[model samples]
Target: MTPTNILSVEAYFDLICPWCLIGKRHLETALGLLARERPDVTVHVEWRSYPLIPATPPDGIPYRDFYVARLGSPQAVAVRQAQVCHAAREAGLTLALDRIETFPNTLLAHRLVRFVRRQSGAEATAALIDNLFTRYFIRAQNIGDGQVLSDALAECGVDMPGASGTPVRHDLDWLPPLNGPDDLPPRTGLGVPHFVFNGTHSVSGSRPPAALLEAMQRALARAKQIATRTAA
Candidate 1:
């Protein structure tokens, strides 16, 4: 049976950040395990936009050059991203850190995700987000281009129209929620991949699948108690 109470998780991340990819994979693993153990926990995930380097241009920039000029050199950025790749791999994800070509402007991608969220469900949007990250990071594809995004959306069942049509520009928005350098709630002080259990409890970061399962179980129990009390 479908759980009456839905668990909502707001993920604030940018495609350029490799940790974000790791976080997503861990979350998916947690959800899959939960589905097997407790079939009643309904999860609804929302993708929020968070730019790692907002000053970067929309046209796109060579990732190595951009990082080297800001930090040190191409080798240094590679070393850092390599750590992220290792972490992701440990969490059962494959990431190609060395082949990253450019850090494309992801504002448009975020807009496309939001548009899909409005039309499709949260699960579909999450899948699309995963695909975009993989294409850019692993396959070294130019996801900054609108044509690529449009095609990806269509492949994910979005049915987007032309490049400049409504489907492409519908969810393009400038503002994002929880405005700040850190993405979290007002009181919880959490981070990205904030798993909100029935709008109350939350777990941040790339957590273990077991921990996520436990959280879902607790949330389900609490929801049942609330319903029982209401009926009484």
Candidate 2:
């Protein structure tokens, strides 16, 4: 039987952030486990856009150079990359950060995700997201480039945004639910790959699948209690 209980999950993410990809994988695993354990509950995930570095030029900048400048040295950048690579391995992803030449601005990619989600729904949009991440992180493609993004979308059976003459809005201003002047979503408190369950219980970072499962269970219990009270 279809689960009558609905668990709303709002995940704030940025395409450029590796953690977001890893978190996505973990979340999927957790959801699978959730289905087995709680067949009475259905999960709904909304991928919210949270561009981490909006100031990046549309053309983007050298990936290595950007990190070196930000981290003060190539060694520091290497250290950070190593840490991420270790975490990536844990999530069954092998990141070739060095092969990635450009740290492309994610505005266009984010816009495409929104466009695809609106037109094709969540499953197609989810596939598009995976392809985009692979194109940039694995294939070393510059995702900010329309051609790269177009190619990725094609792989997922999606067309480029605005192809049908409908204008593709690059700006994220329409998502006014984000509080404050920064890109940080109020629910997340800080950083991408943040998850909010049922608009109340929130968990930040790329947590393990078990941790996510616990949070989901708690959110379900809390929501059940609320519904019971209201019914009475």
Candidate 3:
């Protein structure tokens, strides 16, 4: 596995997952560090869709109530929110959890991501993903809504389909199915924000930028070693 100048990062995530957003920010920071420290390496990130709450209605359910039920009590939900807020702040993000009113089914959102990725590229798709996160978590907008998704696409400079005027399509043959926790090697528990580096190394959860940077370095080194061995 001779290391090439290009390094690929595959991130499996769900749109509504709070920790995924934080992990994305940390990964961006790590990439910035890599740019400064390893100028020779070009990093590419591919976002994989994983719907965390596939059963939620497209219209969504009361956000607060959903959390209260999931966490077993209102107080528990509040405690979890506080913990998430603190973690988000460390990642330089402000999660407006109170503003959110709905917990939406993310199937449409994931399909929209695949549509954007096909129409444009990874950079544009990433921009749309970021916007989706902001809309859902920060702006409290329902991303599962067709109109909301159309507006988001426009914001990302992507044109909506003429007849439908919405990006939501039932056909997701192009986008690969979400990987089960067992699919990836070296498991670290089932969770979003799973970052697979160079197809050989992986880091789970919202790791700090420093830790992510170290993982990237290790992946790069391993790739180089493999390439060297192959060449010989």
Candidate 4:
């Protein structure tokens, strides 16, 4: 496709994060809107793994207890859950937080994504990511389990590597430093559901579809402007 004909979106997310799941839904909605309104633009999305809790044991920790400790109190956790649930409902997703039992370390989960992307392609990798988020958040399955990850790969029409028993180590040192709008200084902390549009503009958090759509448009326009200047 020509430069103007394509739009690139890079999404940084983690499977165990409820907000990332909600953000995925919102991003999908925004893509659909782009498809309907801007048929001439072919969007390519690249999913980058960002493990929220990389230190948790592979076997996992009790979900409720982990959150309770993280939030400092049951009441605080409840309030946070309510807020997440409301946002999830708005995005047409159901947060089954109660169904979750274990809070798994997502190192393996992210490795699985990279494996799928290398083997099949970005499309299959995206499918695997969606499946994983559903399994973790909605189905409340232990995503860190080797068998579970193997099964998830199979569901996405990917082959289970023979080395599945061995944990795959990933190097995330290549991730670009996050820089926000011009007026705002670069953020030192990383956040889930972060989006980079055409590698030129970025939006953070689980923003609404409208906001994401605007980011995409702005990125596309900026790209075209640069391309035009270059062609001149």
Candidate 5:
């Protein structure tokens, strides 16, 4: 197939969401599995932004309390978190929920990611995303602080303010509504870590890579059928 015939998928995610991280890993695993079977098909990805808890305060708040109030009772929250932790471990990922004191506004982090995207391609962007997750989930670092972000960016060879010149802060207003055409409404106006495949099919929440791969294959197949019909 021609390069134009290749498939492209856009993913919307937030760094703070544990399920998003698991979903990402599962997608990667699915891609690797697909590669072994079909090497000819090219799958391209674009990352978008979706803040799960946009109101997350700076300096961080107690994540446990936040979940309890937002989700249910403290005991219920703990149980839910345990389930997530198990899922993460099953996915070969370590989730340090204790370290996440509060969910900071991820607008700045998303901007930094966009900046990294500009400096490096998708692979680099993916690496940076993974690194950010590791820093929070594994190291339990405070990612809400500018200094912490600058340090992380610097480690990735990404230039940030304070390190070189002025520090760059993200504009939250401009951060959202970054997905598609200027007029298209956002999918899952509330849910985060949304994945839109071929700009047609959208999967809300973090899904397994097998699900994503299947979505891509379906999109590709439909496109091919349309092309064949038009030609015939």
Candidate 6:
């Protein structure tokens, strides 16, 4: 029998990015495909943090206005959203893009996810991530709002007892603790929803399942080769 090789996947993402959610779905699909094809390879995923809009106001700005300004017009925003919606549908996700109201500073939300991972476990962490994204993208709730976050925490069975309950200052200049060699080259010109396998194979953006599956196979193969060389 062939010995199984473990592949470490570090997924750097932020809750505010809808593409990240789509990437999550794609990764899950890729893992399922990988299991059938490469039973000798096992995957271990680590969800890491990457804040997209760290400068957002603590109270958050209007989502529609922000996108309109960034995209240059309401019409442009609609076109961009349509593009996202088309991609979301392909990923088996339904995103009510117009339902979103706030472009939030996601510092607290990211911290809360880290908290869940540390206290509850992987299942709880996934549940909380979905809860936050559902509330924000589907229901269009303000994730920066204390009430929204409080409800999500309760639903996820996370007990963050000592939370200050005060608003996070947007200018706090905080950064999440990063690990491994997942950083993409500057030439890539992309952010969030990045996947790194075996600390070497990395891809950015919302890749299709087949592409992701290919990366996993290549990474695992390289890992086994390195292992064989190290043992020799």
User: What is residue 58's positional error in candidate 2, in angstroms?
Assistant: 0.9
lDDT by residue (tens digit), candidate 3, 113-194: 8777777989999999999999998898988886788788879987655535654443333445435442233443458888
Residue-by-residue lDDT tens digits, candidate 2, 138-215: 888898887677677767986543647986434433323333333346743468789999876888899999999999
Which prediction has more favorable lDDT, 4 or 5? 4
Q: What is the C-alpha lDDT of each candidate?
A: 0.70, 0.82, 0.83, 0.82, 0.71, 0.79
State the weakest 10-residue window (summed lDDT) of model 5: 170-179
Scored against the true structure, residue 78 in model 1 reaches a CA lDDT of 71
lDDT at residue 33 of model 1 (Cα atoms)? 88
Summarize candidate 1's per-residue lDDT along 123-187 as a digit string, tens digits. Answer: 78888998898788788877777767866887787665444554454333432433443332345
Worst 10 residues of 1 by lDDT: 175-184
Model 6 CA RMSD to the hidden true structure, in angstroms? 4.5
Instruction: Give residue 189's error in model 6 in angstroms.
Output: 7.4
Which one is best on lDDT? 3
Clashes of each: 0, 0, 5, 0, 3, 0
User: Where is the poorest 10-residue window by lDDT in model 4?
Assistant: 175-184
lDDT of 6: 0.79
Report the alpha-carbon TM-score of model 1 versus the true structure.
0.77
Error of 2 at 116 (Å): 0.5
